[model samples]
Target: MGVVRAAGAQAAARLTARACRIAGRGATSLPGKVLLRLDPAAIGDLARRLPDGSIVISATNGKTTTAAMTAAILEADGRSAVHNRSGANMAGGIATTLLDARGDIGLLEVDEFWLDGVAAALKPRVTVLGNLFRDQLDRYGELEAIAQRWRVLAQSTVGQLVLNADDPAIAALGRGASSPIYFGVDDSRIGLDAAPHASDATHCGTCGTPFVYERRYLGHLGIYRCDVCATRRPAPSVVAQEVQLDGVSGSRFELVIDRTASIVELPLPGLYNVYNALGAAAAAHALGISMSTIVVGLEAVRPAFGRGESVAIAGRALKILLVKNPAGANEVLRTLSLEGGPLDLLAVLNDQIADGRDVSWIWDADFEGLAPTIGHATCAGTRAAEMALRLKYAGVAPSRITVCEDLPAALGAALDAGMGPLYAMPTYTAMLELRRELVRRGAAGDSFA
Candidate 1:
């Protein structure tokens, strides 16, 4: 009877997927939603079908890109991974990926809030916890709450853990595990003198005392130590050293795996991407993949979805950078600041349920740094006026800021009105909408599973 139910759920999911494809809609989450509705245990059942066992990646940011990088690394070794590459990362999304399973290994990026449930069911062979940040407070509550949940997940898991040592919240989870692989940045040249104001997890996880930063990177991620408990950033076995970031084009860094080092020419911009690459390399190393293969695979990877993804429209290029919270936005803004020039930007802010609904995070981001670089700013989405106001306060003149509630019109104007490089910064839901509009205009390709 149980076998029959499982078969029935898979068949239903397949049918829905077929219909979705026929209807020209991308195969994303609706099929998995139906599958889970039919059989709640469908994820575990399908995950077990993989011969190489499963791997799960969870974080507030960079999970999708990290998962994509990992998949690329495995593919370099002639192995394939069934992944949630389109960024539908909930339970329904996981179920859909399994329903359409075609590879020996299952690589998934699970949502931060859904990590415990998904990990409990899949029991992945290698679980990667990158970092934790204050995101979507209306939905996920506090950062402490998510860290507590991750601690529980880490304790319960029997698999090997791969963690970011720079993040105290993530590093603390290793206390309960037998042996965890820790990865972090070691180069001081790329470090910030002080942490950003939007930085979360400043205090020590063990004690209530605040942490002292030796070298701060994006947000609270960097070298630091607790004066009270003496807890410090773990020396990462996998590290990116002597980093050099080039605007928009890419970044070059030496990927040091243990004592061996290889120069990595990553085609993605920003230091945040370097973190993603290191995490992916560490996870792949835990899975027995060689460092040489990891380096080759990482160099071959492109930006995932709206993350530093470039699209050609009207004979000009439009680069999309998805920013929802302060930390992520700061990194994007910092990257843009690296290219010294007048910039044309189309900023979209959405207050949908997926985007936290509370738009207070915009004020928390340090937009003042890039204010002088703005040539013209076209604000769009549900909270267009609010974004324009935020930019105004950040030092962008009122004459330079234009609010357009319509996304298509705003994008068109930004493209036609600009002479130099154009950038589109949008929240989660806004990215989807922008992509859909681009697809309708034949500017971008459809997303796949």
Candidate 2:
């Protein structure tokens, strides 16, 4: 009887989704919202019907890319997974994915705030926690609050746990889990000489003492030890050693898992992406996927939407790199700095509820590092003036900064002004707006949802 009701709700949701598409609206979260209202158990009932069970991936960042990498790996291994390809990752979005699934396994990237409830409902076979950083202080309170919730979820979940060993906060979560799998970077050549100003996890979560770092990778992710508590980063079983980063093009790294090594020529840039690949590889390893298959999957995985997505329009390349929080923005800026030339940028800053009403995080990002290289910057979105002001304070010349609150006008001006590749840095809502403009201009597909 329960299965019958769940099926009926799914059918109704599908009809609603079709109606939304016909009406020219995104059916990402609305249908699932309706389904859950009709049947609260729809998520679990539909998830359990999958033959190969489910895998849950969650973090403050990189969860979507990590899930996409895992999905690609599963595809390489000849397994089909029902995944949430779009960035919609809350309960309604996840339920919508389960409703539209045509595969044997469920692969999901959940929002950090929604991970507990979503994982509880899905009862995933493998749970991957990448890393935690300060994000959306208004919505998520503090990093410690989310960490506590994750610690509880880790303690209660009766499944395989895959964790990032370099993050002190994430590494500490493996305490009571049954043999958690740890993944991290072992390449000192790629490490930063000093920690960035936007580093989040500098203190040990266990002892409340400052962590002594041997090397700092992206933000607070690196090898560290606490002198007082004797707590240190776990020796990861799955590691990325001897990494080579190539500007904005891609990266190469030696992926070592359980004493076996394979060279992965990843088509993604930056050390943050290397961490994303490691998390995905570790999760796949936990699922018994072969090393060669994982490498193939990592090599073939494409960028998820605005995270390093590029489009060619009007004889110039427009690259979209999503920047929401400090850690994420810093990484994007760092990657742009690698291009080693003057850059043309379209920066959008929105204060939508999804983007957090507080727009103070831009102050923490390392925009100064790329200031000297910024040839021309057009600031757009709801807070265009503030973004332009930020660039000016970061050492960018006032003459080089253009303030245009409208996205379409700003995009046209930025493209016309640049002789080389143009970079677009936008927050969540702003990215959607920018993509919509791109789609209308026939540069991008309407299938972003």
Candidate 3:
């Protein structure tokens, strides 16, 4: 009877998925939502089917790219993993991934807010807790709240843990795990002069006192310590050292696992990506993957969608960097400042449900870094005027900022009236809309599962 019920639920899910596609809607999460409606136990049941079990990755930023990198490494090691590659990372998304899974192990990027529930369901063999930043305040609340919840989840989980030693919030989760593998960037050359205004990790988790930044990088992620409590950043076993960032091209760094060093030429730009690679390598190391395979796979991994994805349009290249919150946007701006020539930008701001309806988060992003190098900028999406205003206050010349509520018009204008490399910075839903527009114009190929 249990087998018959499970088979019936799977059939219903497939039928719903087909219907969604035929109705001009993408078959991403609707099928899973339908399946869960039919069988609440579907995610756990499907996750259990994998012979080698599953792995879960959760973070405010970089989880998608990190998961992709981990999957590439595992695949190179001849272990196939069922991955949630579409970037739909909620419960419905997890269910969809598991329902269509065909691999030895499951590799899932669980949304930070949904991690507890999904972890409860899958009970994965390894749980990778990446950095947590202040994102979607309208939805996820304060960073401390999310950290408190994760601390509980970490304590309850029986799986092996992989954590980012650079992020204080993530590193604190290690206390709950029996044994945790830690990863971070060890190069001081990439450290920031000071923490940005938008930095979230201001206070210590242990003492509630302010943390003294020894070295800050990409917001509050860096070497720090609580002077009062003496709590400091964890020393990571797997670290990236001697890092070099090539604007819009890629990066080069040494991957050090337990003092064993190997040069890794990753094809993704920014110090943020270095963190992603480190997190992926650490997770793979916990699963017994060789360091050689980790290096080879990382060097071959491409940008996941709008996270530095390049799209060519009419003899010029348009680089898309997805920026939804303050910390991630700060990294993109910092990376852009490193480029040689002036930048032409189409910055899109949206207030959709997926992008957090409260658009005040844009004010928190540090756009001041790019003001020096910005050639011409166009703003688009539901809140284009707000973004243009942000640039104006960031010291960009009024003549350099253009506001177009429509994405296509903004993208076209930025390309037509600008010089040098073009950069598109869009919120999550805006990225989807822009991609659809690019596909329509035959500028980008149709995305597949």
Q: Model 3, range 126-164, lDDT digits (tens) per residue?
A: 998888888988988888888988999999853989898
TM-score, model 2 to reference: 0.98
**Which parts of model 3 have CA positions greater than 4 angstroms off?**
none
Query: What value does the lDDT take at residue 399 in candidate 3?
Result: 95
TM-score of each: 0.98, 0.98, 0.98
Candidates in order have lDDT scores of 0.91, 0.91, 0.88
Q: Write the per-residue lDDT of candidate 2 for residues 1-449, one digit (tens) a residue.
A: 37688778888999999999999898888899889989988888888889988999998989889998998999999999999888679999999989977898999999999999888889999999999999989888988899999989999853799999999899998997889999999986888877888788798887788999998898999999999989999899999999988888888999999989999998888888999999999989999999999999999999988889899898899999998899999988988999986999999999999898899999999899999999999999999999999999999999999999999999999999978899999999999999999999999987564
RMSD of each: 1.3, 1.2, 1.2
C-alpha lDDT (0 to 100) for residue 113 of candidate 3: 91
Q: Candidate 1, residue 204: CA error in Å? A: 0.8
Instruction: Supply every candidate's count of residue pairs whose N, Cα or C atoms clash at under 3 angstroms.
Output: 0, 0, 0
